[model samples]
Every structure is written in C-alpha cells, then in structure tokens.
Target: MKDPVLSHVRGTPNLLLGNYDLTALGYTVDEYFVAGTAVSYRPVGELGVDGHWDVVPAERADYLTRAVTVVPADGARFNGTVVVEWLNVSGGLDAPAVWLMAHRELLRAGYAYVGVSAQRVGIEGGAALVGDLSLKTLDPQRYAPLTHPGDAFAFDLFSQLGAVVRHRGDELLGDLRPERILAVGESQSAMFLTTYLNAVAPLAEIYDGYLVHSRFGPAAPLDGRSILDPDTVASLPCPRFRDDLRTPVLAVITETDLVGGVLPGYCTAGQPDEKFLRVWEIPGAAHADNYTIQGAFLDSGRAPIEDLAQAFRPTDTLMGRRLDRFLNFAPQHHYVLHAAIARLDDWVRTGRPAPAAARIALTDDESPTIATDSHGIARDGVRTPWVDTPLAATSGLNTESDRMSKLFGSGELFDTAHLHRRYPGGRTEYLTEFTTALDRTIAAGFLTSADRQEILELTAITAEWRFDPGAFHQSGSVR
Candidate 1:
C-alpha cells in the first residue's frame, strides 16, 4: 500500500485548544496543520476470524480529513526523535496521554511533539450531541470546520497522517525533521493501534515503531456500526498482536489492567514470540491515576483543579477533591512510559532489543488476582520505590465512592500505630529503606538517572506526610 496523497490541507489560522492560549502553553496556532487526503489501504485479515491478513480487495480507498497540532522546530526542544502522539478522544475530549507526563522530559530531550486529532469525537461532534465534552461545544468557532469519517476509517487516517508527516513534514513540523517516528496511543486508542499494527501496519508500513500503552484486546470494525455485523462486535475484544511487526513495539500494562482482566487469558506479559515485543505489566499503577489528572492539566497549562471539577461528575465538586486528600496509591505509569520511549528509540535506531521484563504474579483462581508480597504489595512487575519503600500499603486495585475514581485506585498511609509496628526505627530507617529501593529500581532499568530529582522530590513529599499524618487526614479524625 502506497502512502496517501495529500489532496488538500488548510491550517487553522487562529487555533484555540480548550480554554488555554496557545503561546502560554508553548505550542501555538501557527503550528497547526489540517489535512484532507485519499487513503487506500486493504483490510487483509478477517478481524476476529482470520490470522493472516489479506486487505479486502473491494474496499481499499477512503478519504479522511484530520488535524495535527504541530510544535514548530525552532521552538521545539527536540531530542532527535519526532513523536506523533495520538490524542485520546475518550469521553469525547482530546486527552494527550504522553504529553501529560512526558512534557518535561520531551522538552528537555528536544523531541518535537505532534498531537493528531484523527477520531470523530475530536472532529464532528457538537454540543447538542456531546455537550461540553465535545471539542466543538467548548470552542465552536475554533473547532467548527473539523470533521471525521468514522472509526472504521480512523486507522487509515492515522496511517495517512504519519505518511504525510514523514514525507511532507516541513509543511507540518517546520525545520524539525523526524529522525524516527513512533506511533503512540493510550487505552482506547491503544486498542485501535493493536488492530492498526496487526492489519493496517503490515500494509501501510508507515511508522518506524509503536508504543501501544495501557491496551487490552479489541480491534475496531473496518466499517461503521450501521454497517457492522453483530459477531464483529462480540469478537473485537479478543484479537492478537501480529507476530510479524516489521518494527519494534513496546506494550506497557498496569497491575490494575491485569487483575481487572483487561487482557484476556492468552495475552500474558511474557508471550512466546518475536524479539520486538516487550510488555511490562507494572505493579502499583492505575489506568487513570491521581498524578495523571493533576500532571495532565499542569503540563497542558490548564487550571488543574478547575478543569478536573468541570470534567468530573457534578457531585464530585472541587471542594470534595481538595478535602478528601490522601497520598495517591499508584505510581505514575508515565514515568516508565517515558523510559520505554527512550528504550524503543534505541531499539529502532540501533537494533538493541530491550531486556524483557518479568510479569506480575497472579493468584490461583478462576478470576485473575494479584499475588502479593508479605507487605501486601503486588509482586514481579516493574518494581518501584512506591511498592518497596513501605510507608503505605498501596495497590493498583482501588475501591472508591464513585466508579471513575474507583478505577483510578487509592492510597492509604499506615496509621501511626501501624507505622510504629512496621517501622519501629521511624523516619531514619524508612529513609534508608527508600534509598535501597531507589537503587534497586535504578539498577533494574525501570528508572533512569534523569528521574533522580523527580523521585527524590516525591520522597520529600512523602516524608512530610510520614511525620505529620494530619496534613492529609480527615478533620474529625483522631490520630
């Protein structure tokens, strides 16, 4: 399959993403590139039924129009690699998974970031349908002209975007050339990439590599729901990754995903196949975490608390979030995600395959559950100081008052009674243990030297809570 022809492209002259000013957030309207193209790619494999792909000969061509918010080269702090981050349009909003956490790292490394709006929710929807959740509703003037064909055409649209960006990058990214472009998507988009890599990728051959973060199974249908067969919907949840990925692919799943049965029984962390596949089912991490909420807004230069307030259910007001404060349970998955990006770059650039990681241990039961250590921490996944440091008993699985926060997980620091029993030597011994855990994490390649300052800063935050538990306690509580 040849790359798509850039039939037409018109930039959004005065772009406004959400409520934030472009310049204040660093990237601006002048960097915007909107394109329409003729995409011809065959769906060779019969989604759930067939293994070997054969692009359906009859329906190979589709036209798509999409947007890419470009970060100009001169203004970019690029790290030689150009990252094409797929905007996660779940809940009908443009949520950038990587840019949320890796903003600081990306800026430091000088990597040019492009946020692609390739899905319908980011394009066609208006207030009548999706309300404030719709990009068009929030800012109709800026997003009025945007449109998407449907999910069926999304893969080809994404492929075309990458193809166009690689060959015609100057028009989009300016002087910053993409040394290597890794296609990245998270959760819902990750599921799409699973299909994209298995089906479209074998044909299009566009991206250098892929980072399919926080994925389970399920490939979207090749045609829209009005045309989708019922069996296709049932079978979507159980598709496999292609063995013949011409490029390296890294998949990072959290313990929350594992225990919750996001991946089917066959898709374990260590699958017996290609050297290009690396899956890290991390312990003490959540699907949508507290850090992600705060960091995501902070990185995008939005008001963190207020934005969260508007997005969450009305019952979950800003004051409730401010009051029910406890140390977060899960470690930020983005920390490891950033490292995987670096590792994947090395693998793509020099053919140095990353070391395969040990999978998280699960319990012996029909329903999947995590195997635990004496401290009740999940075992065998990416070992972070969060699980090893021993201040709070934190797990990726959470039970909260609401479904949304419940899925994100919870953290409970050891009460003074429990702390004294666990760490009799107090803060001194705890600090020593934390230092040891930090060393172990760094040695294991889970953490890089660049992360030292951030991790140390976190330890300080924990220390404050360690001595003054009241800082995060309920007003009526007696400690």
Candidate 2:
C-alpha cells in the first residue's frame, strides 16, 4: 500500500514540453509524471453479453513503473474541479482532445487539470514504425526518465492519478482543494474509459463522474498491447457497457463516431443504463475537427497551426470523394461539454442527475444513418444553437470511403442568396432567435450563462465569415 513515487520536473521540460504552450488559457502550467516500480490491480470481471447481467469477477496482477501527467490549477479563478484527461496517443502525437475542447471553460471556471500518460506511446516511443512518437523522443532530455510499464497497467495508473489530484499530492493541484475529480476521455481514450468503468471502477472507485466523449465502440482490450502500438488493431466496433454501474457516466458521441466507430446495436445494447448514463448523440458533429484546435489558438492568442484537415477538399482520388459536406464542427461541443461537466459537479455533490438527452433517431434499415429535418440538421438529440441557427445546415454522415471521417463530419452551408431567402429577418432576426434559443437552452440546462457573451461574440464573428462557395448549396437543398 505504499504511495507511488511522484516527481516534479523543473529547469527544463524534456521532450514532453516541446513548444506546447498552455499559458494563453490563463492557468500557469506545470508538468509532473508519476512513477512506481510495483503496481497491483484487481481483475475486471467477465465481459457482459447484451441483456445478460455480467458476472462480477476478481483476480490480481502486478506491474512495474509508469508516468502520468498532472496539471495543477494556478490562476485567479478556480472552479474547484480537477479534470483529468487520459492523454490521447492516437494521433501518435499527444492529442489532448477534451482538454482542447474544454480548456477555455476549465480555465475560466478555474478547474485544475491533469493528463495521464497511461498508455505506452505517451511515455515510451511508438514501436519503430511510428518513429519518435513518445514524449522521450519529442524531448529525451526532459522525458528520458519517464516510463510506462504497458497498457495492462494503464487503468491502475489512471486510478493513482485520481488519488494524486484529490489528495493534493503536489502543488500542481493548487490550494483550491478540488471538490470533485472528474475523468474524461475523447475518441480512443473514451473506449479505454468504457473498459475502465466496466472492469476497473468496481475494483477502485476514484473519479466522481466520467465523460466518454466521441467513444465509437466497446471497452478497451483487457490484456492486449496499447492501441497506439503499431501492430495492434486498437478499435473495436461492438458498443457495450456494464449496466450495473457504480458512478455516473455521461457519453457525448459525435456523428462521425456513430458512422465510423459505433457500428450498430449500440443504442439497443441495453447496458449504459439511463439510471447511471446520459448519452447525447450529436447530429452534425465529427469525431475530430478544427473547432477545438482553433479554440486552443484563440485561447493562446495564437493563429491556427499547420493541421489543415478542416480545409480538406475531396479530389478525384479514392481518399477525397463525396466529402464536400465535411465541415469543422463549430464550437458548440465545448459549450455543451462545459455545461455537462458543471452538471457532473452538481451530480457528484448533490444526488441530482444530469439531464438525459434524446437519442439521435437512426434509420429503420440495418444501417445507422441519422434522420434529419429539411434543413439537413439532425432531428433528434441536443440541438444547440449551431444546429438551430441554420447558417450551415448539417449532416453527420460520412461516406464509406472517407478515412478522414474521425477528423471531419458533414456540414454544408447555404449560398448567400439562399441565406437571405431562408431568413427574411436577416442577421437581426437570426440573432434574436439565437438569443431566444440560447436562453431556452440555458433554462433547459444545456449551456451556462457564462458562455453566452462569448458565443454571441462568436456569432458576430461568424456573421462576417466569408462564405466558402465550394461547400455551399442552394437554400432548401438537403444533403
């Protein structure tokens, strides 16, 4: 029961701190990695088949040292929540998706944050084929000592991190005394959490609540290599969850995740129960996009970086066909997630439950296509202002050939003449309706008042946005 050896890095950031600046968001950033030579874990019982109660089981295992990231909240504003993001090594680069999406809110609300480098690729370099995809390779001087035992030990490592933030293992968590330790994961990390919730939570209950965003399918591999490993097929499409749960799990899945990651029967799987679960199937959003990346730039007061997946155009070749509808998911997701984390805080503190959202209605056929209104926006689920405000009509569907579906989802804007035709009241009318909708949404508990001014300002900015004709269609046209 000895505490893991926790070390703070000072003077210079080894490969891990390579040009990744977080100061623009208002919080002073400090990076520390947790390491331990001996780690133990209780087994994550048998997998539950659909509708059958899973057999709760237990076993024991031991592993070596691993490093996890801890970012303390050191700023004027502290919201008293420590959001620990399971650092994503999916891109071979540490893609902090949820952090990027929710950082503005976390910083503004004064929440402490941490990134757990539980997987191999995060601490150890990707096995040869991926060349230098490790924090060590990125900065050997700083990251040289960092080590991760393997994927089998990741769940325990994450659990240890939760304890670190809650107990104030270091000054990185600040003096605010985090009231709730929230765990969230995006894309691949989400799947890992799904597994953790099912198998690990029963053994070690650490986090107050969980946000499984953009989770495409089932739980992570029990004893396999990390998905970021070059040889392993990391993703599995079977969407499953343990119905008999311990903590609240709020899952927000984008359109691209549905088509690409979650195949079929996820909705009807019967687990991920309503009592302990809240799943929001967003209509037109993608698995990944520039909104979060751009949000980082905006927060940092820096311009956009080189990743131009948003500007992707389909060519005659196989990679770029019928992808005209792909639009960078607007910033609505962050707002929604911000509100959700707030709800999570309330749910953990009080016994209050987070509001459940309507599931995105799927097609009758075997295929899982989202049904849409005449405006091409999703008809069901949480319809934020971006979906309600018809500047850009939406579709979550991606063509089968689109390998870039995770980074892009379907959004097609109306032509200039068509915009005027769709909204006769023009910008004035649009703003009024949007304000009304924002108010209603806030009342319904989907957004916070704190976000209104910023969203409204963004609306003003978008109103002046140069319409990209290449991605435009005539008004009343449905994709």
Indicate which candidate wins on lDDT: 2
Tens digit of lDDT per residue, candidate 1, span 1-479?
A: 55444333455532223344445645543434354543434454354433344564233444444455546335545555778877776545666776665655565565666777766665665212113355566667765656665666677778778876788877666676777888888866776777678777877888988887877545555554411234654555455566666899988877655654333332332354367787877777766665565544444424543333222211212224532434244444767776777778878989988657888888877766778887677888787777877676666565455434544654566678877887788877777787888878777777766776656655655565565667534222322
Model 2 residue 356 CA deviation in Å? 1.5
Candidate 2: regions farther than 4 A off = 11-26, 37-45, 50-76, 127-132, 171-176, 226-239, 261-273, 300-326, 400-405, 466-479
Report the Cα lDDT for candidate 1: 0.61
Looking at candidate 1, the ten consecutive residues that score lowest on lDDT are 310-319
Report lDDT per candidate: 0.61, 0.62
TM-scores of all models?
0.82, 0.82
Candidate 2 positional error at 22, Å: 5.0
User: What is the model-wide C-alpha lDDT for candidate 2?
Assistant: 0.62
How far is each candidate from the true structure, as Cα RMSD in Å? 5.2, 5.4
TM-score of 1: 0.82
Query: Could you give candidate 2's per-residue lDDT for residues 173-218 as a string of tens digits?
Result: 6456777888999877887887788767776789989988877654
